[model samples]
Target: MHPPTWLTAFLDLPADEFDAAVAFWQAVTGYSLSAYRGEREEFATLLPAAGDAFLRVQSVESGPAGVHLDLHAPDQVFEVRRSPGGLAYCLVSGTESERPAPTTWEDGNRSQVDQVCIDIPPALWDDECAFWASATGWELVQGGRPEFRRLRRPARQPLNILLQRLDEPDGPVRAHLDLSADDRAAEVRRHERLGAQVDRVHEGWTVMRPPAGPVYCVTGRVPSADPT
Candidate 1:
């Protein structure tokens, strides 16, 4: 099957912190807010001023705040069938919409969310990696380090999938988006100005916390032209 065309990186925040989380993300990504969704206004799409939305923020009833991916396909059941081993995912219909082309912000930084990294416990690491590989039709390759694995999508796809094996074997699964930037340091500074705290720098990538949101990374990579 052909891979899906749309991908959304979702930030699941604690119910009380939703507003702050949305504000922080909007400032950092320079995206405008789409109309709020859900019964209690628990969902919102973070749309780039000119591009397809690859990010969203949601308020969850419980559990630690984290991230997940929403892959839009013509047949939701087909996509779900690709995932096995109890991966936490759902298939929703009628959620697709048109998006504008991507544009760069005044900071001279064009950001593209090019990767989604799933934090998997040791026991489930292999299975999870395999599932993502099957679901995306992406090749599973070893990452730069042992603890990391990557599901590299075809060149045409907008995002890559990564599986990071965590040392802890008994925690909830979490995910994070990796933004590729032309100038890593400058982008990090820009995000800092928008209320993101630098948690630490690993290798050359900067790990950041957006106000009350979960952590994500800024890496030194050329932003892909296709923003969706």
Candidate 2:
């Protein structure tokens, strides 16, 4: 009702978070899979009496890795393009969220960001957007805003995630996590040569500050990959 859903997938990653975690864990422990592979490098979907719950989805090259995620509705195996640095797909949870609200990492570790969020609810936003279009690698960024369905991100890390309004409805999580750094675009141009601002025109990332708020810093996006 306020701001939870595992702190909105640990700050960001919604927009189709693995189709809201494999269509709500296969409609609550029904189990199902098979239908993923444009190339296939990673895949997961299980319930096993609702315990070892699974939902992986991997296969990156031109996209994916910032903790990849994708979820929206009906239509699987294809059609999830938008994250070409525009970033969006992050967060999924209908009700399962009891781990968030915590942070502290400049190398010290001590984390939480809700351990990377996911909560479902909103009527399972169309099979959780087909398990977030195969766990994000499905690619898809630069979305819309015909008012409000959800979109408030710097891709988490001090940033907040909210998009309530869509008729409102909640309940479903089970588990989730995505936070990333995989050498993001040379860290977004090394934060635009150190000043920070790398926009790249539209559907982009990198907007540093650090003094304490507004930080999506990956400027020039990493290069050799190593948030160290």
Clashing pairs in 1: none
Cα lDDT tens digits, model 1, 1-228, are 445555667788998888888888777666789999889888898876664566778899998787777777776553333243344554444244444333477866677667888888887887788877776667899998899999767644556787889889666667888888878888888888888889999885889988887889998766766533
- C-alpha lDDT of candidate 2 relative to the true structure: 0.32
TM-score of each: 0.84, 0.24
Model 2 lDDT-worst window of ten: 219-228
Q: Residue-pair clashes per candidate, as listed?
A: 0, 72
Predictions in order: lDDT: 0.74, 0.32
What value does the lDDT take at residue 181 in candidate 2? 40
Which candidate's TM-score is highest?
Answer: 1
